[model samples]
Target: MDLEGLKLETERLLLRPVRGDDFESWAAFCADPETMHFLGGVQPRAIAWRAFLSTVGAWHVQGFSFFSVFERATGDWVGRVGPWQPEGWPGTEVGYSLARHAWGKGYATEAAATCIDWAVDTLGWTDIIQTIDPANTGSQAVARRLGASLRGPGRLPPPYENQPTQIWGQTREQWQVNRLRLRR
Candidate 1:
């Protein structure tokens, strides 16, 4: 897990480590009420900066975090998606968030599926989860598209401990079977 050299590409996206230059788009995403609705509400610019920095710090401390996602054709910062497991997290997770404008294009699924594969194959994770707010139909759709099944209610760690979520996921064995079937 050489964090600096890490990068994952899908047909329409480039997922890589968060960089200083990404703050603008990151802040914009954080400020959007719709985009941040399930992600702790709209954050002020200053707060968003702290959140952005935390993602950068996670890569240094944990060797993995949400990778900043970019549109391949336009080189626009679209969002962040990938492996994440903070202290007290429910499980090893692959999460995604995209700017509002990037929505409806299946970018989350594309980026998340790649991250899930890496977690299972490269990181040797036995299982992975996505803690999604139940009202977030879009994310639930992405989870379903990835072959994850709802495992019932979940809770976030402190600060966000009260927020209700649903755990959706699959075991590595299950993902492998799905992958093989997908290729068929």
Candidate 2:
């Protein structure tokens, strides 16, 4: 996939490719315990920047990477969302998080919906998994809002540290049905 200028625009958020310089703002969000609860734990700024750059670089190499989400009205960085392949998972996963301040505003759902649309419409991906920490009821709610069905337990790497994850899923058939209904 030629991903020169890939961007996904939602009603209240602008989803764009993460650049190297987004370190400071992105790190601030990641550095928080609440925001990073499902994403391992808080990390040093340097580690956070490196992780962000890894996502940026993955965009070129894997044709997809975690996107930086910003509020369109205020132009403030909120969090990240996108498709990823966890170490042992067989299919691609739709992963996301939002700053504590940006919570309850539907930014995560809005951005995640756009990514789901792209996966089904543009990328021809049939099945997408959303792995949420069992304790993260907020994220689980977001997954449900996107029409993803619970698929059972999913495992992840350290930091996650063997926490049991609930896998929510959306198939192409389900997405297509929902998309048509959305259009109507």
Candidate 3:
């Protein structure tokens, strides 16, 4: 809730609210072939930017939303990572997407861990879910690494003709347990 005032920092990323000016880079990332692999391999720049705005606008209305992710070291827009609760979903779900070049570097894991920590520790979120395209094994691996247990396949009907996704999640209790184990 109140996404505007929120900011989270991880080892290599800073999670901040997406702004109007970020549209260009965000669009480029969303439109890139490599980066859009899981998003049906890219869309028109206008379409991507409009979608991004809808997401941000929803945050304003819903009180919780995704944050634009930036690589702290290089200060570049790496993409977006945050909590997503679409119309049909059961609970607040964690979602993340990054530029293609940022892959294989552990940034997704680090930023995601930080977001999950904040979700449970500060935001009082209970069940966190993530639906990763079955073909995006890299994202599925990141989900697993973040301690989300696989919950099986999910389908997004119509307009979104993507491959089936594998759902993964962690309850607040599970997140706490994992945190404690890490501390130990």
For lDDT, the strongest prediction is: 1
- Across residues 111-152, which tens digit of lDDT does each residue of candidate 2 receive? 887887887777778898898878888988888877888898
Residue-level lDDT tens digits of model 1 in 68-101: 9999999999999989998999999999999999
What is the C-alpha local distance difference test score of each model? Answer: 0.91, 0.81, 0.79
Summed backbone clashes in each candidate are 0, 0, 0
- TM-score attained by model 1: 0.95
How much is 99 displaced in model 1, in angstroms?
A: 0.5
Model 2, poorest ten-residue lDDT window?
175-184
Q: TM-score for each prediction?
A: 0.95, 0.91, 0.90
Off by over 4 Å in 1: 181-184
Which model is ahead, 1 or 2, in terms of TM-score? 1
Q: Which of candidates 2 and 3 reaches a greater TM-score?
A: 2
In candidate 3, how many Å is residue 47 off? 0.6
Candidate 3 — which pairs collide? Answer: none
Clash number for candidate 2? 0
Q: Write model 3 residue lDDT over 12-130, tens digit each, in one string.
A: 78998777878888888877888887877787987887788878786787756678888899999887887777676646777888887788888887777777787776668988888
Error of 2 at 126 (Å): 0.5
